[model samples]
Target: MKLSDYAKSQGISYRTAWHWWKQGLLKGHQLPNGTIIIDVDSSNHIRETACIYVRVPSVEDQDDLDRQANRLTEIALAKGYGVKRVVKEVASGLNDHRKQLISLLKNADYTVLMIANKDHLTLFGSDYLIILLDQLGKKVEIIEDINNQSEDLVPEFMAALRIFSQKIYGKSMTKLQVSHLLSEFQKQFAPEEH
Candidate 1:
């Protein structure tokens, strides 16, 4: 259950729950959606330095990120990794804070770090992912491309767009024909910069 809910159920406030955690009495995993799960048994592995870091494209994308993060977490848990703390940040590949990301990058206690793409691994630079990969000592597995799978809705939307265009033209629409038309339409009517 969530940390807040667990705290409420146990008749303690959230701050008290945090205090218990800081003292190594409570253990929790921070889910991508900003909820924390606490397990008494998991607390037993509490170490002064173990942790994990997760980077996402945006905070607004949390709704879409839950499934991908869940898959990665499942694999990590199955491998018997003791994950203590987690870092979640809304950072884009093209424009992210190198200093802020690196502050978490040089962690020495984490055994695994699940990342979305080469962009994430290269948060610091090509040398950084290599350095951390070497330091962790365990092979870094590149999970499925979460970003690509995230665009699955695009095909469905394209089909719908084809159907709409057929109605607009009072004729049938071929996937190829509709795609070409859509491309032209998009180029002509692309959003204007403010």
Candidate 2:
């Protein structure tokens, strides 16, 4: 189809479609006379459109977030995935109300979600999200998975305990009390050394 027709079919501006083509995101070519053609009938065209997601724990990590997004974009392009959009957020992985992440999950325009790490999506419940995305006919590409490192568990557990303690006891629980509780909980549940 013509580029204009493809743009109209996708309900996007001609300039946006043109930019996608210029960026090598659209599978198409231009003729000598300047007419652009798009291969809308390709079997895996829509399935290859990817949305890159990157997140940082705080606003202070803005540079790290940018680096993550850039790295993910490079990976996606190298894998021949069409870069549809890049969503960046400065929120803790334990945060459940990340608006950008939620919006991206809801949007069906992209078939793949690319991230530098699994925890970039969430520190907890990430497996559930991956399973849900798979059931929805979508894919998640993790560039580097350091999730299995035992050292990462302590901080995540502390954060989770802090949040739960705050919710259960409101704002009245002291840091000392939370720490004591965490120690007791660990003593009861920690695996025994052989």
Candidate 3:
């Protein structure tokens, strides 16, 4: 169906539909001949998934942070989360503080929360994660795996080992090694965290 037709069927204006497409809320595919096709199923998937938000630095160097935000948005969408509001570096990390991340942590509604790294944790550490986990207790599951693998298993395994290795060995491991070990000891770390 044409964009106008789809918009009419949904009782919304075509302009609104175009806005969603631009925001990545609605997806469109271009045909070989140059016409675009909108996948209603995928669009419906977007409607169903939970909102995934990103917080980044709003400095003159927003290019890199924008790319990072997009990467994380893709990961969250793949895991079946919707792309909701993006609270950019609206939160500052000055003087070892993260008011925005903390506010997000306090709210704790998202299915998953993806952060950059330890610097993020240093500003907002395990204590912050635990605080959200405790408040969200049983409402949602929290996973802290940061392995940028193409497969789900790798991320799951890495998350497990991240918790296990830290608990057992009290040491940090690289994402690549964690991904490898996760594949090696899949059964050993099948148990869910929290």
Candidate 4:
């Protein structure tokens, strides 16, 4: 396909496509007449379109979220994975109903889902998602495989316990009671200050 058509298909400007071609991020060749032809099939075989997914546990981590997205974008670009989109969201990894994530999963534009960490996508069942995406001819690329890294798991545990307690206690357990219980639980496990 012509470079212009390829750029149009990718929803990018001609100049950007030309730049990518020059940077060797795109596979193609220029003819004697200065017309560039893109080897779409070859490029698709070598590099898949990527959708960078970035998330934070809360709004307070907005800066971290931007940093995460930027880092993933750099990685994706450096890998020559044509980045189709970067979806950023402020939501708990334990939350199952993240709107942007759900939407991204349903969208078929990209073949690769790039993320900073597994927990950035979800705290649990990330393998299931990866399997499903694989079944759908899509894949996930984790920049930092920190799955076994030592980190604070108290907040996630408390969130899960709170959810289960709410479900079990129904309307009997008030929000205040849950919060109090979680607070105490956190205090017990929290690291001591110097």
Using Cα atoms with residue i matched to residue i, what is each candidate's TM-score against the true structure? 0.44, 0.62, 0.39, 0.69
3 or 4: which has the higher lDDT?
Answer: 4
Q: Model 3 TM-score?
A: 0.39
Cα lDDT computed for each candidate against the true fold: 0.56, 0.79, 0.49, 0.79
Model 1 scores worst on lDDT over the 10 consecutive residues at 44-53
User: Candidate 3 on 16-124: residue-level lDDT in tens?
Assistant: 5566666776677657885555677744433332333333332433564566566655565565454443344522232245565556656634544554443333333
- Candidate 2 clash total? 0
Clashing residue pairs in candidate 3 (N, C-alpha, C atoms within 3 angstroms): 50-82
lDDT of 1: 0.56
lDDT tens digits, residue span 100-156, model 2: 999999999878899887887899789999999999989998887465345445555
Candidate achieving higher TM-score, 2 or 3: 2
Regarding lDDT, does 1 or 3 come out ahead?
Answer: 1
Q: Candidate 1, which segments miss by more than 4 Å at Cα?
A: 1-52, 96-100, 123-128, 135-139, 146-194
Among these predictions, the greatest TM-score belongs to 4
lDDT of 4 at 153: 51
